[model samples]
Target chain A: MDEGRRPDDEKGEAEETAELLREYERQIMALPVQEHVERMLTTLSGLALQRLGIGEKEPAACSPQEARLAIDAFRALTEVLAQDEPERGGVYRATLAQMQLAFVSVAGGRAAGKGGAGATPETNGEDDGEAGKNGEGL
Target chain B: MDEGRRPDDEKGEAEETAELLREYERQIMALPVQEHVERMLTTLSGLALQRLGIGEKEPAACSPQEARLAIDAFRALTEVLAQDEPERGGVYRATLAQMQLAFVSVAGGRAAGKGGAGATPETNGEDDGEAGKNGEGL
Candidate 1:
């Protein structure tokens, strides 16, 4: 009787686990597309903002206001990606990638201006001259 | 005159790039949320199917038919995640994680079963006896 009971319990547990997994799968499959996109975009935005040093403890040398504006711009771009038209999605993706690349390039440029390694003295002088010109214009 | 000309050219290029970026950002921002979700879910489904060896050249040892069915199930799940509600996004993410974990678990279980890593000789014999009993019952 004890031997039979052990096998039955094991079978029951296995069944329960399988059922739980099936239920989980069903719930996941039921979610609407907009929700998933929103989640992914939100996650991406956070990652991008962190990389840009927006809202971080140490202020980036670049204007924090400009960084915030850039983040807002990205959010706007994500909204465009969320559209229903199939033709638009590809365009949006390519544009988004381009935007991200632009932001990254600007960040790299600033890092170079901060006297980082790989920045030649000539480039450093050029950056300083540009900064001086920007100050004068301001 | 040459120095002035070069700076003007550089500024013109910079302005042109910035305008292109702004236009791209505007286009993306105008997209509806539904399209965004569909794209994300489709990407996820494709990745999952590839991982499960559904489309890959290096086929897994599992039954191809079974793998196809599993992929279909995953596709269904992605369709569900494409719904419009924000509140359900968390549920969708959780479900995605669970589905991925289930695939990993099944793969690990098959490997362990093949290796006979945890099954003792006595337990194996008992399992064989149980199978024989089931066969006789059938």
Candidate 2:
């Protein structure tokens, strides 16, 4: 009887886990494709903000490479949505515009910190002069 | 010969369109599932910000209902990712934390504007006094 009880308890737990998984799968499948897309969009936006160090508590989290990929991926998806669902696309466009603005701000800050990496010779010189002024100010 | 040419040209155009669609589908299929999820996350983030009227040029675009849905959807998706993909999910958690802060700020502003709509009676009375002061100044 003890042996039988041990086997039954294991089986019962296994069955319960399987049932839970099946219910989870069913809920996911029941959601509309658009809802899934919306969830993805929200996740990507958060990733972008994190990568850009926007609103991040830790500025050290900024990753230019990851941010670029996230932003590019976002633009590509939004462009497709714009054509397929123009009504909702307007909101996407607005969001993209703001993201671009944020990217520029972050990128500009980085470039300035690096003394204008990839800047033209003239621009580099100008940046150096500005840095000198900033140094003086400090 | 003219009739044949007309029919052939129409068939050729249809085939070209079909080929283009197939190419697009192939490109989409070749991408890793993670990329799709990333793109969706970005889109959701943008939608959330747009709904929240954060960084939005048009203040009228603010919709509390949509913002709530976007934020909820973002959190749900991020929570799943935290379990399924913890390495990348760290970024998601950071994003969610920032998002919550933004939500609190926006919600607080709205409540203030509404003269503490859902505040305690004492708080509401205090808000009304503040409003009275502004009204007198006006």
Whole-model Cα lDDT of every candidate shown, in order: 0.45, 0.58
For model 2, state the Cα shift of residue A1 in Å.
18
Interface RMSD of each: 13.8, 11.7
For lDDT, the strongest prediction is: 2
Q: How many backbone clashes does candidate 1 have?
A: 17
The first chain of model 1 has a TM-score of 0.36
What DockQ class does candidate 1 belong to? Answer: incorrect
**DockQ of candidate 1 relative to the true structure:** 0.03
**Residue ranges of candidate 1 with Cα displaced over 4 Å:** A1-138, B1-7, B50-138
TM-score of chain B of 2: 0.67
Model 2 CA deviation exceeding 4 Å by range: A1-11, A117-138, B1-138
Residue A93, model 2: Cα distance from true site in angstroms:
1.0
